[model samples]
Target chain A: MNAELPRRAWLRQNAAAVAGLVFGGAATAATRRAASPHRLVWQIDPKKCVQCGRCMTNCVLVPSAVKCVHNFDQCGYCRLCFGYFDPGATELTTAAENQMCPTGAIRRRFIEPPYYEYSIVEDLCTGCGKCVKGCTTFGNGSLQLQILHHRCVQCNECAIARRCPAQAIHRVPVEHAYRMKSQAASVTATWRHKEDGPAHA
Target chain B: MPKRSRIWAWSWTLVVAASVLVASGVQRFPKPDFRSGYTVPQYTPPAVERTAAREWLDVGLLTGGLVLAGYFALARRSRRGLWILSVASLVWFGLVRKGCVCPVGSIQNVVLGLVSPADGIPWTVAGIFLLPLVAALVVGRVFCAGVCPLGAIQDLVIFRWRPLPLWLRQFLGMIPPTYLAFAVANVAVGAGFWICRYDPFVGLFRRSGPAGLIALGWILLLIGTVVPRPYCRFLCPYGVLLGWCSQLSRRHLTISPDQCIQCRLCEESCPFDAIRVPTPPHPDRAAARRRMVYALVLAPAWVVLGAVAGWAAADPLAAKVHPDCALAAELRTEESTGKKEQSWETRVFRASGRPLEQAEEADRDARRRLRRAWAWAGAWVGGVFAVRRIALGRRSELADYVPDRGQCLSCGRCFAYCPREYVRLGELDGIRGQP
Candidate 1:
């Protein structure tokens, strides 16, 4: 082919071949070296959350995938629950004005004398972490934010993770999806969080 | 620093830390004693719904798109076929998936994997990233023509040809490579993924995001109505890599089936301004040789100059982009002022009980790495463009107008405008087949 064409054309063709090898070769090598067996998705470690409320706004989803979660085992179940009631509130009722949660997402119910259970309304929970801040400061750190796997689009680099000042968001394996509190701690033992009980959704 | 204030800040931080740690482990009010009959309800949050099978399916669909795009561009030479395939790709990849594991964003994943010890790139993601480059090397930019959702979305809005002056086009062309260099550097230094952070079209695809990003997307699409795939030409980091392989394509797309007839219609037809007008043989071989020689000799100086400029930007980039460096700077301020800002990071750090020196040391290491990565990437960008200029100035053997291999996306748009193509398609009767 080169014998039929001028010298410059022949040289240019060969240069193209050489350029292909260099660029394609390097890209191919990078791709091969980058392979992994495990699939990973973005998650937030409940233990590391500082309740800065960045999770509420930083998510690409309109209403962020980050939601307020309750760890039932760790809850003190107190009637004067700090997560549900504002610090200055005179009444411990579920009145909107006295609620620590801006969206009124936390519901309080009487389970026993002086023992009340708190549950989060996922739709209304803005993940503001206002309640999380109150809970961590005044009560047991049972209320924390976790990235819901079902709603998470799983961006290559999670938008919320990048801005999370606490740096709690991390990539975890798909099997261990939610970093939820899973164990029932004994009275003498420290609270343990791991995959336990029938918690699959 | 005053001793009292220093002691005050330290004690305050420690007290909060102690309370938080104790709060996590110990219940303030006892969980009902063993004698009580209360049962704690189990609260399980949502689990992963999308499965491994979708990844395989994504890879398969991408491969099918690439194969179909190549066939439409090269074998069939039908612009209509290409557009149909492109719209389908945009719906599936852009609208339905809403942009995950895309080739454009995967560049960050590749660099992040190289820098960090986190699980290497997922096999599905690697395939998504590498498949296009492979196609470009074998054929030419088959990905850009119809397969890439980014290109497709931009392709939809382009209604007119508003070609910029040659000088401005040449100047703007350098952006993609420079953007690529900075994106890689940002990832290497533990800066957030700037590519995903500022992807102009993500807001449009997902139908919601920060107003600024959504506005940017709309503005680009508005400009694209006349400017024609502005992101593809000027901003896409991955397109720079595609251009490299496309230039060396084994079987390049030809604007004409047989020979260029000097008709100049293809040049008028292309919105991308990718068609190169014929350049007659040079009168002075010596002058041309001298010009090429000057570019080759001064290439190192261009690279060094670029590196120096990039090094200047590296300091601020490290402080602002990387999370740890920002934290370290905040810590330094607190140590000097003896007043805490109540930032989340500091509270968490104090509670974790890690020494301040360790964090400061990590920040120092991060800044140095970021600087070197920026400088090296800048140098590479400089060298690549210098070589590109030299190549652009060189002589071509053909006397007829031809497609620029590096720039032409091979979208098959020009195929309809060529008179020779009309004859090939049997739409014109004057010319039967090429003699």
Candidate 2:
């Protein structure tokens, strides 16, 4: 009987911790279930990215976390992209030495006439805002940082709020975030090449 | 003087081995542009290469080996062996591998947190980083003890001795798992590795970056006051994970009863409390039985309860028992005045792609199924347990074999390898401030 009182007293004193642990266990389980069918919370709107370079510069991480992604259809395949080359290139060429953005985030691929492919090496991106600035000012506003939704912290209020010009940034529901740009109708019409078709949705 | 000699000797040996491997690997493996970063370059098509050395290095093989070795030595009371193995792992993993094989990819977490996207976290890279860590846990800090380049580096530099109390150590140990769960969950939800953002060693090793190096330098310098390698003990979730692994280590470091001379030197020596009182002569049979019963009861209960509760929790109208879930958040956001907003899981049950009617009548069938599943599972598990105790009235013979992957992260192994865990400081004192 005496032991019962001590045990009850001990339980009462540690009630909060016990409750916290129980609650924590349930929360852990819920988090696991929620994680199973992963969703894209942040999205990149290909239409708005000016490639202003703000993503590289204004990001909180040391090696600016903003990595450039590609939209194969919209690219001009111009001998040069302000996104790739510096202020001015001596000539349109694929020389390793004469590129623009410092970290070589862009990779060029050849695919028939007037449509060479360009890709971003995400790990190499420093989010320096240089590419964004160049692309927005000189080329199609294609190379923008759309938060990758996967890499973003989803801060209640975004940390980059103060620096974002154009005011283009806004949160959307997670389900609708990654609305892939529709396939270019012309490409869809031509069934000559299976490889040249629209990307997976 | 004795420690410094060990450090010097190990450093030289590591340099030679690293140089040979790099040379051989360079010859055998394809080389990506090493100078690609430095040269003022635009978009260049860098060539890709396939090399076995690069593959293993990238996967953190050396670090894993070194950590395992260092912990083995520590557990066995060979200080010289501990220092050598620890140093080798850190140098190879950090300096040669170029910071790629890291579980600390916070970028993924950041993205998840920002967008709250519905895609599962990418496990490919995470799996690679965790493999060696898991191995270390199973075999003891074999990773931190000998292979983790970071722990190895810190192991070489530690110079002092002050012991922390057990209660405080346990308290601090508790913090990393929470951090790990949060980091992993956030990453799964699209947030990048959040913990890596504040990693102090990255700055220190790079030699010079931002002024944060000054703060890091002071942390290293404080080794003079307390025992050396403080971070492994108090921080480093990776180490905690390994310590748990060490408990079940297959190829473990064991004391040779004859070689020991019964000096009890190793007991005093272990900074991590790893050299526990030689497992009591005979295990406490009563306590063991009780623990076995508890685990036997709890394991099946968790699986059964988990499924049922998972179903119940999915109902939007149900009261939230799990905090911090995205589903729970959705439920909280629903602005129903009186009539309950139906659960997301419940909504999922309706004809696919069809929207739910706000009225409960539409959900009648779905609600019945949900309740039935929950009740049936719970009742079935409960009945089994009751029957087991009543029919057998005896203890379970088999031991529980739960994997440490989810719950027991591998950080403790790293802590065990570091000699600095012995240090007992009240709080981070007037440490040098960073600009």
Candidate 3:
């Protein structure tokens, strides 16, 4: 009887592990069967966004935690990015007080002539209509929150879908969840320069 | 009567069936096995509609049933008119509003937001404090006996009539006050509400959230099976607050000596230990008066001293990564005008401030000393208040046990434990049936 006790304890512990394994296998099978095309909620047509601040406000989250991410290669290195400053700009100061939008969504980086790399700090983004509207109105749709698929809860039927006005958001195949645009030829040349030739090209 | 029993049995069967279905629902729509996948709550504003009905039911029943049971017990000891009034008030405040000032949810919210400051005060807290106060003043601590959400949960469980070791309960009780102090200080600093973050049972009832918290809930629920509502007893700040309020509350759960069947039944039945026999050879008026004076003088002083001591004691830790500490760092950072300060304050503040500055190490030493002095002062104040309570006279000789809502997390054990209430309301009234 004493000898049997150890065996019984082992079974008790392993029972959960075994059940988990079985359940996991079944869940995986179900997931495969349930899989429909993958979808991306956020997309940036950097050229189209007018920086109107619509995305900042209309979003459900309080802080709107979504901010613009810049793909340097895709950028035109424009001197006046709608993403950065208001059209009626007086001075190009980096101080938060002097920004186009009320909240400072744009972070400017100095690179070369007439071209500065700009990025969005997301947590501060209120999803107000200003930035998105601005970007869509002026420059390339460079600024948009692509609903970072990983961050999304992936509710089987998206909640935001019912509310989206433009209906610009669509479900893309999961395998190609995000569609990142390659830079223009000139920008591509710059990108390849370092990789192919001079170390710091 | 037979029909009532039949109805009860049928309802119980249905409840069991529903519980089984709901529990199994987790199994059917098998969530992703990935540790992070289905379990972890990604950062998102919690949606109100997302709250599952089962969870809401559990929360409502737990808070409602226990308070109701306590009321019934206490009512038996009081005048019939007083009892009726108390019951009506309880129904209006506790059950009608669904235990809004539910100590359980409020305490949990406070804990959850402690690390994150942006969170707002949950509405349920307003209900928990207000309902009980209104009830106690008008009807007496009927909320404490039968209607409080947390008390209901505890009363419903705690099956074995074993006495917890005094030293053990005392040691455990210390945790809630410390938690209370931590919550109050953090809230004052605009740090994330500490009360809501780590609530074990709220997570359990909700059935989904961040994996870490959900796991903690399950552990607590399992613990509840053996130890009663451990969170309500040990770590709830709201319970601590209510316990104090109940102490001062005029319309308390009073037992009449005329009903004198000194059966000791109520004493044994009460899980909260609110009921106690009056100690013999009570202190004379002079002694009582002296004690009351001491209580009045020492209580506020102790609170201040305790606050200071607690603050000073934990300053070094608080200075780092505390949300409030971040505010101070921001101030110092601006004062330096980008110039590096080598002071001790700089070091303590550096870690908390945004856009980390390397020179602020100097501020740490001075800050630590000041905070320590403050903490010592606070401890003395708090220590005195605790002492004065012992000196004060006992009001109720035999009372029904219900958790203090200020510290309780509204877990459903008390409601489960009150057998008489369970019989009256049926098990579904106490149990959060599946589905």
Residues A88-129, candidate 2: write the lDDT tens digits: 678656676667768777777655443345678887877665
List, in the given order, the native-contact fraction of each candidate: 0.50, 0.03, 0.00
Error of 3 at B228 (Å): 2.5
Worst 10 residues of 1 chain B by lDDT: B112-121
- The parts of candidate 2 lying over 4 Å away from their true place are A1-201, B1-53, B63-82, B103-130, B207-225, B255-262, B277-435
Please, what are the lDDT tens digits per residue for candidate 1 over residues B1-435?
A: 899999999999988987665745655556665335767898887868678998889999999998998898888888899999999999999999889889899888777655553435667776887788878877789899888999999999998976689888888999999999988888887777889888999778898888999999999999999999999999999999888888767776778876777777767888998888877788998998899888888888889988987887788867787778988998898889998755877777877888999889989988898888889888888887788778766876656767777888989888987888878777876454333
Question: Which of candidates 1 and 2 is the stronger one according to DockQ?
Answer: 1
Q: Which ten residues in a row have the lowest lDDT in candidate 3 chain B?
A: B24-33
- Top lDDT: which candidate number? 1
Model 1: CA > 4 A from native: A1-36, A182-201, B1-30, B33-38, B334-338, B350-356, B430-435
Displacement of the residue A152 alpha carbon in candidate 2, Å: 18
lDDT of 2 by residue, B23-122 (tens): 3322212222333232212332222221334555555564445455545453444545656655654565465443433544322332342333232233
| Docking quality category of candidate 2 according to DockQ thresholds | incorrect
Over 4 Å off, model 3? A1-201, B1-129, B140-157, B254-258, B282-308, B319-321, B324-377, B392-435
